[model samples]
Target chain A: MNVAPNNQIPNSQGLVKGMHEQEVEIAPGTLFDAEEMVINMGPQHPSTHGVLRVILKLDGETVRDLDCDIGYLHRGVEKIAEHDTYAMITPYWDRLDYVAAVSNDLCYVGGVEKLLGVEVPRRAEYLRVILTELQRIASHLLWLGTHAIDIGAVTVLLYAFREREEILKIFEDFIGARLTAHAFRIGGLWWDAYPEFDKRVRDFLKILPGRIDEYETLLNANRIWLSRTVGIGILPADEAINLSLTGPVLRGSGVNYDLRKAQPYSAYPEFDFEIPLGENGDTYDRYLVRMAEIRQSIRIIEQALDGLPEGPVMAKVPKVIKPPVGEVYFSIEAPKGEIGVYLVSDGTTKPYRMRIRPPAFINLQSLRRLSIGHLVADVVALIGTIDIVLGEVDR
Target chain B: MSDEEKVTPPDPSGDQPQQSETSGEKSPQSAKTEASADKPAPPRAAPSDKPSPPKAAPAKKPSITSEIAGDPFIDKIKETFGLAITEAVQTLGQQILRVNRDRYLELCGFLHDNETARFDMCTDLTASHWPERSGQEFEVVLLLYSTPNNRRIRIKAPLADGEACPSVSGIWAGANWMERETFDMFGIKFDGHPDLRRILLPEDWPGHPLRKEYPIEYRDNEWTDKHIEYREVDYDTSLIDVKYGERK
Candidate 1:
């Protein structure tokens, strides 16, 4: 067994050595270092979902170790949360996970409301359910499109975007903005839904089920799709729970835990649906779970639209919002996973401290375990399965 | 463990002895909140391993002061590990326990393993700074949840400036990055974290930006000329120097 010298060790000629292909003739006659090759795979990559940079140590085509180098997109959002008043932080929540602004807004304002002991109207709660379910579908659509593209399924991207555009239109019709729509207040909604909000959302629900079926027909049983995702990233049931992963990733590992279902908040109890769980906990299982959740999201939205209540959306409150001194932890089931707002108010308009328990940021920690023994190419699929948004990951 | 562990006991001299006796102590503000009578409670996870509660009603009634009288976890921990719990009280429909930083891990393990208080998830761990509080200025708050009972607990341990906050990663692997992030932002050291380094900020960044003494203005950014060249970008360095003199 002839092992090449370590990179730190010098050959007879005193030329520096590093891990490289054996054919490379760096010096007169020095073999390449025996160390595993390390590849930095983002900060500017299409498959990375956002600006997430992963430094992967590889042995041939297999990934030996994975170290995620996030914070490239860190805007110090938590630090910013300390400075802004409770009302001002609404817009900032939209920036954490840009795809699911409604969910983010609900978690933050919901926590603040809990601290202040404000009661949201039943009608307002129903409206929140309707909007957030649609947001979940939209967020999952973006994830599916990019995830499929990562696995070499380009056609799914076009099909996913088709449905996603209509959801965005519904969002714009009422919320007045598309991507980072800062559309929530602490006590309740800033304004009632636009008249067209119901009709547009209903129209979207009518067509979304068929669109999802079309997506399933294209890739559900396809040989190539199965080969790429079926058993690629296998995080067992126990490891999944131990890692504190929430949402689809944890559910895919056979955990029947969803915050919306387990702890009903904001009219979630009014809707009827199933909590989808997968047994294998592989990439394919995660895909199946998210696909099932899209159908469930549609189910929730339809119920909310039909049973829409009539009342004031915004609650009566004082001009200056001041919550008593205490801390509250509010967790909601966002599309990707559980997004929690840990708020500590110091009896002032501005929050003393606010911490967001971002699902993507924590979920990314399990990537090292999932990627260790897999191929270099499979790292992309693992990342896709985790469904991380770098804005949340590096926040 | 230090011999001078000032684990504040449930002071008999304090105003806590009897819930019935405190009916007269209810303030005017609490009376107003009580008028709603049906203050909507925050959701609680239902028992029976069911994902969602079958019942349509919220978990607890809006007025949460009643349940604080018979709080089980706080009572149990006080009886079991008397000195470990520095302070325990009910707040906002949950138990807030201030545990000794030296015994934080042991207490966390007991909570994780104990039958009734099986807090399965270490949801969040971070620190907050209060410069005005002289002796115990920094407080590390850890939130835990028990999936079985559907209960949540907040453990806060206060420390002086340079004291070490013991790592809980051995008990919950997920606490790794959280502890690192806390250390990164607040400059609180975790005694035994495997890889204790900055998670969200650059490793060589100067001061803990979350500390009160650290200036919040943009002009105070400490990046040097070499870094600007290394991360080549065409931008006005003067913009960073403009103090936030105007309304923020």
Candidate 2:
């Protein structure tokens, strides 16, 4: 919103002189116009969640023009990927979609695997499914926490984070890191899960359903929550499809498209779960869809744990993978939506070209259209409903 | 289990029949040598030679060209718009079409609103910087997906240095952000994009960071000793100006 002053700005003395002399003439055919007030919503605002700045042109409370300014947190990830070797780039992938770091890792590794023509072991595939599903739940927990707080539901944030901490503990047990887990290797996982991993995951599965119920109990039937969300930011199914919206945001709009179901990867095909859809695409529907997805993710993790295969964790590829001179595009269903890794390898340790298909970046597009007629207060609600992580958005 | 307890087990399903005909015992070093060879001979280490002869015919020949010739979409596109399909690369599920930049917008309009190729979604709009190519410095890649047909097409628009590509924002509103992002990354200006500005970088930032030639870091010449000198500023009056005024 920091508008550079025009080079043709009139001098203050000229402005005062003009005001003093303006009374002399009154023209019948003079044109009058009013400039729209531009307001900036932070490169550091709490509602932005990260370094996202939006410049808004407002007529009172209605948003006339909105410009989203990102890259305040840009670390030149693509440039870094070019410099680093294929094996060394997994950590960078973790940073792209920090919330669902495991999913990001999976997408990158999966793409690299396809390029190298490496087949991952059954155990590795199952482990990946378990970890990714857990990561999805954790990510949704954070979304539920922050999103509820953004909508003025203060207590729900605490409840959501409490459950998220347990998931983080499990992640720590497996990967030895909580937030930026560089757990996935090029062909498979960094190492096999610890002895307690299966048991700990099972314990989480046992308690997660009850914990989800507690979260629902706190907010689902609340009159204020319903009133604030229902019928707000309604995106029709056709419009949602046209806008290229995905994940819960698209499903909430009554589109029954899920990459996991449509194009199953890893052990997603083996898992028995339902793809929850909404009749109406609204802020409320999005919330419901995400909440339902959390339970479905738990079901997948439990099933994966029960039938966890015993085998090697990594594929028998060369230490340094050099894919043929070809381009491969692979997409995975991340917590937010479809996170794709488009890799163009020219038979080298380093990727010739690497492009990230970030779901948040795509979902962020609908904001301007969604916010057109809605009040300023509803803007926060709409953004929360979208559930974007700026790490992925700015990347 | 502890490291001592965890034994590295040998490969499982050792007795089971190999699902693929490709040799399983070949070392990684040999594969590298075969890859580096100028003419990569069709892999000959398979356990049996009878099943491979039929595969060699398709492998040695141009498969993609043949596939494109039979594709109904390519023929329909040619029939509808009279635009020749100059180049086609089919790898995995993605199809890349090299088209004329001059007729790019017209083709996009035909693709999006057209009933046959109802590419309702402009999933992604990105550009690749080819610094070595003087005539064609940037190749704008547009990923279009049709939900009705379950088909995807990637359109490539090669632009010369300092040239602008036609913006598809008018066709699909979703392209607004994607095009802006493409502009921010590759510096390929979109001719008719509304409010075209740097989306991922600061306005005053030097150069497009994604361009292959742009250096990652540069010396901060603006940081002078005089600018770093401490000054006695009123804290109480500065709070409002620093917080609310700057935000406004």
Best by DockQ: 2
Model 2 misplacement above 4 A: A1-37, B1-69, B78-83, B219-248
lDDT of 2 by residue, A110-173 (tens): 9988877788998999999999999999999999988888888999899889889988998988
User: Among these predicted structures, which one has the highest TM-score?
Assistant: 1
- Number of the predicted model whose lDDT against the real structure is largest: 1
| CA lDDT for candidate 2 | 0.76
* DockQ of each model vs. true complex: 0.18, 0.23
Candidate 1 residue A352 Cα shift, in angstroms, is: 0.7
lDDT by residue for model 2 (B1-248), tens: 11111111112222123323223433444566555553334234332433434444434322222235567877777675565456766765567887878889989988987788888877778877777789888888888878777677888888898899998877776777788777877788998876576677655455676777664443332343235476454444333322211221
**C-alpha RMSD of candidate 2:** 11.7
* After superposition, candidate 1 runs with Cα above 4 Å error: A1-35, B1-68, B220-222, B229-248
